[model samples]
Target: MTIWMRCFTGLQEVQKEQSDKLQDMKQFLAFIKKEFVHVIRDRRTLLILFGMPIMQILIFGFALSNEIKNSKIIIVDKADDVASRELISKIDASKYFEVSNERISESEIEPAFQKGKLKIVMVIPAQFNLDLHHSGVSQIQLIADASDPNTANLLVNYVSAIVKDYQSEISVPGIIPYRILPETRMLYNPQLKSAHNFVPGVMALVLMLVCVMMTAITIVREKETGTMEVLLVSPLRPWLVMVAKAVPYLVLSWVNVTTILILSVTVLNLPFNGSLLLLFAESTLFIITCLTLGIFISIMTNSQQVAMLISLMGMLLPTLLFSGFMFPLENMPEVLQWISNIIPARWYYVIVKDIMIKGLGFASLYKETLALVVITLFFFIISIKTFKQRLA
Candidate 1:
């Protein structure tokens, strides 16, 4: 009787262990199925994971070719001699520069440079041919609008290369006389550090992206989750609610701006030669402008997904391309250049460069600052109207 009882208990114990193992296996399979469903159902997640990499590659890959072509230029040809004319002809022939105007007076250089009409303004010496004949080497000045310093450098290089080639062809190998000596004077970026060129661009990009994306996304999130209706029913006006939403991000943006400036100065050696107060003020206007734009986008779109796509495509791509972050505005085609003028970052970039590199104050920056204010007002008004419509 004792052996029978013991055998029955052992059999029951074995059955219980097998049952437990089977249950564990079933739970594991169910969890894996849930994970798979999540990965497949959330299309945005999948797109972000895969599409971003592909898009980044496509956008930046072709832009990697640094060849500057069809740059606008004007010549200050004081010498109409055969040598100077021939040199100008060679410069025009090169695919790099398309010469549109020629000035006889040297005083015209400042106005042309200030107007930013052309990239390179070559000033051929008055005695270009005579000097070459007398001293074997004649000097030519290439004043570049170095606001866009990278483009300026490329232009200088192309012109220098052409001059060197011309010299090699004209001069005897050992004698080395009758040479065109190119002297390049960069206006804005004297040191030619790419950091100086790109840091302002980075600031514009960061300010725009953070403020816009955060404001738009946060508002859309509340709408998506149905919390917006609760807020809408309260004492808060739609515009005020949007403002409230943006205020936190606005404060956070200043914090981020400070961090970026600090890092730029300490780590990247970015020059803050301009007033800190003015910089912060300009940055605030830009942030508010972006925030207004974001709220406007949120009002237009019902879902978080659409808002995100619109902001990414609308702000990010244009800011990167038209804002002269990677490619110089002058280097872009005429149509693109015209289009870039409307991009807020384009204006802000000039402001940033003027501040950080040129070390000019509100005196120089007033127009750009005014432009930002107008943009902010325009977007704010539009968003307010949109909110009113939504309430109606």
Candidate 2:
């Protein structure tokens, strides 16, 4: 009887243990379902989780490109002979230049450049064929807008190669070798210093990320911690409160700009050719633009993660792609190029390059400056309006 009773107690304990294990599993599954429901309910979270990857893949595959093609070129056919026409035909046939039909004089080239019509201008000297056939040598002058040094170099190289190919085709085996000497002149950036290009781009990227990302994150963090309500309910006006939040970041961004300039000048040996006052003034304007953009973003989103993701995916990608820094804007599709105009960094990049690299004053930068002002005001107004709406 005692043995049978002990066996019954052991069996009961084993069944109890099994029931406890089963209960734990049910609780775990229920917790998992609760988490899934929570995630599904947050639409922004879902979008970030799924939409971000698709957006990144599409942008990387389509928008980001380095190859330069279909550059506009102008040719002055001073020697309108058969040989000159043949050379022009070859240049026009190449995939690089989209030759203009409008015949422009050599004197009109500078004005055409000022109007940003063409990338390269080729001046074919008079008696080009006569010089080539009789003396076995002729000179072709290639004037490239070296504002973008990399593209200018590549364009010059492409033209030089075309000229060489033409010379080889016309050469007779037994006779004097025909040679077309290409005299290349790089305008704006004579030295072709890489720093001249990279410095302005870095300025745009750094200022943009610092001012936009930091300001957005700071304000969104306040909202996340519920301190934003406290500040809003305080005696201060909401716009003033938001401005107060931006002030520290604005000052910090200014210091950052100053530091970037100092380092660029001292370390990179880049010339500070433009007026320091003008550069600083423009930098302040850009900083204000970025800060206002951040404020707008913060008002739109409640989560720090979403704000950060938006800033990185939205701001960083566009700045890198559209600012004409990592890739040539001319190489992108027309739609992408059109989209680039709305990006504040694009104008700032141009402004910095003009002032810092090209040594231009406010006279040369008024258009870009005006663009920044308009963008700043747009963001500033919208941010204020959104903040008021959200608070109400």
Candidate 3:
């Protein structure tokens, strides 16, 4: 009887332990379900977790490209002979060069460059065919705008290679009778220093991020923390409140621009050839444009997280892709090229390059300056409407 009682006690203890273990497992699963429900209910969280990755992959895959295509090139057929015509035909046939119909003369090249139209100008010297056939040597001049050094280098190389192929095809096998020499000239950046390209792009990226992201976050933080309503109820007008929010960021962004300029000149060995006054004025305009954009973003989004994500995903990608530093805008699809037109950073990048790298005057930059002004006014008007609505 005693042995049987002990066995029964042992069985009961095991059963009790098993019951406790099952209860714990159920609790764990219940907690997991509760957390899962919370995640699903928060749409923004779900979007960040799932939607952001998809968007990033798509953007990175499409926008992060370096293949050059359909770059505009002009051929000045000075020779107007069979060899020159044949060379022009070959260049036009290439997938890389889109032979422009702009009717460029040798004297008109500088003006065309100032207008930012032509990438390369190929000048076939007079009597190219006579020299090639009789003396076995002819020269082709390739003038490239080297403001964007990488593009200029690639273009020169492409033209040189094409000329070589043509020369080889027309040559006798053993005697090598035909020879064509490509004379390469880089216009703006003679040494082809990369700093000339990157400095301006970095300025655009830094200013856009600092002005837009910080301004949006500061305003959104007030709303998120429930202090914005308190301030709006105070003596200050709504527009004043918005202006007050934007002022500090504008000043700070200017400081950033100054710092970048100084560093570019001193550390990076970049030339500050344009007027300081002009550069400062342009920088201020660009900063205000970015600030207005940020305020507009703040007015649109309720939470700081959404504002941040939108600012980063929206502004950063466009800046990197359309600013024409990381990749050639010409290489991208036509739709993306059109989209680049709207990105404020693209204009700013061009302006900075003209001023700092090319030493161009306001005449060269007035169009870009006008673009920034238009963008600023656009965002400012919309932000005011939205802010007034919120106040009402």
Which candidate, 2 or 3, would have the higher lDDT against the true structure?
Answer: 2
**Which ranges in model 3 have alpha carbons more than 4 Å from their true place?**
1-181
Candidate 2, residues 1-392: lDDT per residue as tens digits?
99999999999999999998897666555534543454457677456434433343334333543345688999998999989999999999998888888799989998988888578999999999999999988999999999988779999988998998898889887685554555778777675555677678877887787678877887788799998888777654577656766776666567667767776677667787888889889999999999998989999999999999999999988999899977889999999999998899999999999988778999988999998999899988888787778777
User: What Cα-based lDDT does every candidate model obtain?
Assistant: 0.77, 0.81, 0.79
Q: How many residue-pair clashes does candidate 1 contain?
A: 1
Candidate 3 pairs with clashing backbones: none
TM-score of candidate 2 to 2 decimals: 0.57
Question: Which RMSD does model 1 reach against the true structure?
Answer: 16.4
* Per-residue lDDT over 1-392 for candidate 3, one digit per residue giving the tens place of the 0 to 100 score: 99999999999999999998897666555534543454457577445434433343334334543446788998888788998888888988998899887776889888888888678888888899999999988888889999999889999988888888888778877685554555678777776666677777777877787678877887888799998888777654566666666665566566667766766677656778888889889988988888898999999999989999999999988999898987889899999999898899999889888888778999888889898898889888888898879767
Can you give the TM-score per candidate against the true fold? 0.57, 0.57, 0.57
Candidate 3, position 341, lDDT: 85
Ranking, lDDT, top scorer first: 2, 3, 1
Q: What's model 3's TM-score?
A: 0.57
lDDT, model 2? 0.81
Per-residue error at 356 for model 3, in Å? 0.9
